[model samples]
Structures are given as structure tokens and as C-alpha cells.
Target: MQKLKWGMIGGGEGSQIGPAHRLGALADGHFELAAGALDHRPDAGREYAERLGVAPDRAYGDWTEMLEGEKGRSDRIDLVTIATPNSTHFEITKAFLEAGFNVLCEKPMTMTVEEGEEIVRVAEKTGKICAVNYCYSAYPMVRQARAMVQNGEIGKVRLVVTAFSHGHHGDATDADNPRVRWRYNPEMAGVSGQFADCGIHALHMASFICNDEVATLSADFASTIPSRELEDDAMVNFRMQGGTVGRLWTSSVAIGRQHGFDIQVFGETGGLRWASEQPNQLIYTPVGGRTQIIEKGEGGLHDDAQRLSRVSIAHPEGFPLAVANIYCDLADAIRGEIRDGLPNAADGVRSMSAVHTAVASAKDGGAWKDARPSIFK
Candidate 1:
């Protein structure tokens, strides 16, 4: 199979997400990083590009320069991954999509619902792929959960309870940290902070695994750190299609907790529990039966789960593999191969809608609000 030529924007030196994107793109070998604007500073970007072993001629100082340079090339990038700040997502994605390049963007796809919808419109008009990186959905057990929920193994999901917590932001001093300034700045991270950054992932995961959509929500949000401009914690009560009720608690200031992405879905006949910390195995309890640990590559798993598992049950697959699976799925989609469950632009809008509406609900004293209307049809 021919590898697709790939380019990247952002993910400069010391950026946590940049290496993850690089490792993910390299993991499947279906795409190659041909070019990049690794940082805003032209010199740093070029240096970083060279460090990544990219040809010096292909690296550009900024996104516009890279796009302009690539547009004139015979060996143009087939796709570009945007790992920049939340505020930049709209313009970068639009530019690439307008240039007829497929886009894979990190989430909180856009800062506003209108911007996210505009992306959907542009992707539809361009006929190019636009995927959002909700990487948790790519986990083997997550795939299993989705399949089982859809196949009635869970017998009609009636409720979902999800919590994602991290103590990394617990330090009040971080409010003034130059590194995380964008996270606390509303203009950069948008109207919401912790909820927009981490809560949406939990929201998306619940809907994804349950094959449901969050219809409406009531929310409470707080910025625990003094002088912080955005929220660090959020509690949302939501209802999904077919009467599935759920709650989501997301916090960046949960002292002593780190990477606590956990979910529980209960149906009439059984329930399933999965956590990011224990990604390779799912805890399943059938009504009136003993609890079971369903590991990856084990029997009783669906084809979707088996297909995503890259190693044996005990080997353990986590974040990098999850991202690789997303890249692999994107590669399949780009090749026009049959694939399912890669979060596309519409899904991105769904999550962004939740983010927006949750902020609105919180601001309005926890009043109920409807999520963004589904634009697909």
C-alpha cells in the first residue's frame, strides 16, 4: 500500500501533543510526515523539523507558508494534522480544507458552535475528509463497548455515568504559568476551560459507546482557582436519545486524581465499565451474574474490538496505540476503504456543541439547554 504524504501544523519543541501526533502518524506507516510548521517561530519550526528528520526544504516557518509552499509543489501533502491551540483550529482547518487537503484536528474542534458548523459546511463542499481526534474512541475495549451496546449485549443502555479528573491543574500558581496561559485565557481556550478541554471527551465517549446523542443538559461549572478566568470543574446532567440518562463530572483541579477517565453504562440486562487507566480490559456485569473482566484479544469480543487490538491481552495498549488506531482509521477512510467510528467533522461539532451548551447552562444558573442540532441528513 502506498503511504499518504502527511504534513503537520504546530506540535513544536516541548509540546506534549506534538510528539503524540508524530508517534501516532508513524505507528501505522500508512502516512509519512512530509512537511511541517512545527512552531510559530520560523527558526524554531525549521530546527524542530530538521530534528524530526524532515527535509529542510519541506519545513516552513508558519502554517500559511507551509500551505503556500506545498500548494506549489508536485509532491503535495495529501493530508495535514492540526495540533495547534483551540482558537486556531477553525482557520487552520478551513485553510487546509479550502486547499483541498484532508484535515485531522484535535478537539474542541473550534471555539464556537458556528465555527464548527462552518467547518462541516466547508468539508461537505470540498469532499475532503475532516476528522476530529477523540482518541479514546479508538481504544480496543472502547470499540468492544460500542459494538456490544449496539448489538444488544447490554440490552438497551439506559444510563451512563462518566468522570474525568486530573490534579495536574490543582496548583493555584498555574493560573499565571506562561505555559498554560492559553488554557486559562478565554480568548484562546474559548468561553469554557476545563469542560471544553477535558469534559467533552467524556461526553463524546458516553455517546459513542452507547450509540446515543446527548439531547439536552443542565450544568454547573466553577473556576476554583482565584483569578482564573475559566472553569476548572463541571458537573453536567444530560439526557440522550431513547431515554438514556447520564451524568458527567470533569475536573482539572481534583487533587490527588490523575487521568481518571472512567465510564459506566447500565442497561436492563447488563452493565459495562471502562477506564482509561485500565484500557486493555473492560469490566462487565450481567444482571444477576458474576462480574467479568473482558480483556482485549480474548474470546467473546466483537470483530470491531479484535480488529483494533494490536497486541495480546496482557501486553497492554494505551494512549499511543489509541492515537495510532485513529490514524489507521483515517488512512482507511482516505483510501476509500470501509471503516466505522472515526469521529468526523459532524462528531466534532457534536462535542463542541456540548461544550458550548454546557457553558451556557452554567452561566445561566444550571438551566437546561439543548445541544447543537445534528446537521447530518
Candidate 2:
């Protein structure tokens, strides 16, 4: 199969996410990096794009230039990934989608729920794919968990507990660093800090695994460092549309937790647990039976899980490969195949609504608030 031409906006040199997207997009040989407006700096972005093997003519200065340049080309990119900052997602994504290009946007797809809704509508209107990078849900074991839920192997989901926490920003001294400071700055990170940054992944995972939507939520937020405008820690209590109780804790000040992300789903018949640290195994327990470990790539795995599993059993596939799974699904979707699990613009809007609702609930002393976006309602 011929590789689809791909372009990227932002996620330039030194970007934490740039390498992952590069590795993931090219991992399966489904896409070639044909164009890019990588860094905020025109010359730097052009230079970096060329260094990454993007043709010099396609190595543009910025998103606008890339857009205009690609718009006039007969062989424009089939998809574009937006790895820009949280605030810029809406503009870049909307622009690209409006111009008839598929988009894979980084999370918190927009800064506000309204923008997110607009994105959803635009994607629908343009008949373009506007995928959100909720790539954790693309993990092979997570796919197994979701498939199990869908297959009734787990019966009715009763409760979900999840967390995404880390201590990289724990130091008060480091709080002022530009990298760390922007995360807590309302101007940069918007309404919520840690929750928006990491909690949504956990929240999305809960919904993804249960095949349910968050209906309502109550939240408590805290900024441990005091200098920050946004919370560094949060606890959320939520209920899914299917009546599943949800609990999520996300923090950036938990000193010992390294990449701390995990989830446990309890259902009427069985329970399932998976952690980012142990991405290969899904721990399962029937109500009255011994716990079992479901390894990825093993026989009897659900088709989605088995299909996404690239390495042999016991061989680990880390974050980038999970991202690659997302790209894989995107490739199929772009080729006119239905990829039901691929997170879309609707998921992005719902998450924005949840974030805004969580922020409001936190401000209201942990009062319960409707978590669905108005459009959904």
C-alpha cells in the first residue's frame, strides 16, 4: 500500500510530543512526513522540517503558510496532525479541517467547550476526520478491556477508578520555570491545570473502557504550590450515563509517582485493571474466581486487541506504539474503513465540557454539575 502523505503543524524541535508523533505516524509505514510548519520560528521550523526529510518546498514557515501552500497542491497531504499548544488547537484544527484536510489534534482539542463544539460541527460539515489524541485508549490491552465490556464479559460496569499523576513539577522552586509556569498559568493552561493536562486521559479512559459517557461530576481542586493560578491536584467524582460511578485523581505534585496512570473498572460479573506502567497485561477477576492476567498478543484475545498488538507476547510496546495504534486506526478510517474506537471531535468536545464542568464544580465547593456539552444535551 502506498503511504499517505502527512503534514504536521507545531510539535517542532525540542517538543516533548513531536518525537512521539513522528515515531508513531511513521512507525507502521502508513504515512510519510511530506509537509510541516513545525516551530513557531519560521526559519527554525523550515530547517527542522527539512532535517526530518520533509522536502524543502514543503517545509514551510508556519501553519498559515503551510495551509496556503498545501491548498494549491494537487497532491496535498491526506492528514495533518496538530501538536500545538492547548490554546491554538481550535484555530489550527478548524482551519485545516475547513480546508478539507483530516486532522489529529492534541488533547483539550480546544480551549473552550464552544470552540470544541464548533470543531465537531466543522468536521461534520466538511466530512473530514478530526481525531483527538486520546491515544491511551488505543493501547492494545485497553482495547481488550473495551472489547470485553462490549462483549458483556464484564457484565454491567459498576464503577471506575483512575488516576494520572506525576511529580515532575512537585518542586516549589521549579514552579517558576517557563515550562512549569505555563501549565498553571490561567492564560496558558486555561481553567484547570493538572486535571486538564492529565486527568482527562484518565477520565477518557474510564469512558472508553466502559463504553459510556460521563453524565455528571463533582470536583475538588488544589494548587499545592500557592503561586499557581490553577490547581496542581484534583479529585473528581462522576457518574457515567450508564450509572457507573467514576472516581478520578490527577496530580502534578505527587512526589514519588512516575508516569502514574492506571485504571480499575469494576463490573457486576468481573473487574478489570490496567496501568500505564504495565501496558502489556490486563488483570481480570471474576466476582467469585481468582484473578487472571490477560496478556497482549496472546491467543483468545479480542480481535481489536489482537489486531493492534504488533510485538509477540511478553514483548513490551510502550507509549509511542500506543500512539502508532491511533495512527493505524486513522489510516483505516481515512481509507474508508470504519474504526469505531478512533476518538473523534465529539469525544474532544465532551472532554472540554467535562473539564469546564469540573472547573466550575471545583469553584462551587465540589458541587455536582452536568458534564455533557450543551450540544450533546
TM-score of each: 0.97, 0.99
Candidate number of the best TM-score: 2
User: Where is model 1 more than 4 Å wrong at Cα?
Assistant: 374-377
Report every candidate's CA lDDT. 0.90, 0.96
Clashing pairs in 1: none
What would you estimate as the lDDT of candidate 2?
0.96
Candidate 2: pairs in clash? none
- Candidate 1 residue-wise lDDT, 1-377, digit = tens: 88999999999999989888889888878989899999988999999998888899988899999989998889999889999888899999999999999999999789888898999999999999999999999999999999989999979888999999898888876667877667878877788988888899999999999988888999999989878889989999999966899999999899898799999999999999999999988999999999999999897789889988888769988798899999999898888974788998988888888888888899999999888555742
> How far is each candidate from the true structure, as Cα RMSD in Å?
1.3, 0.6
Best by lDDT: 2
Worst 10 residues of 2 by lDDT: 171-180
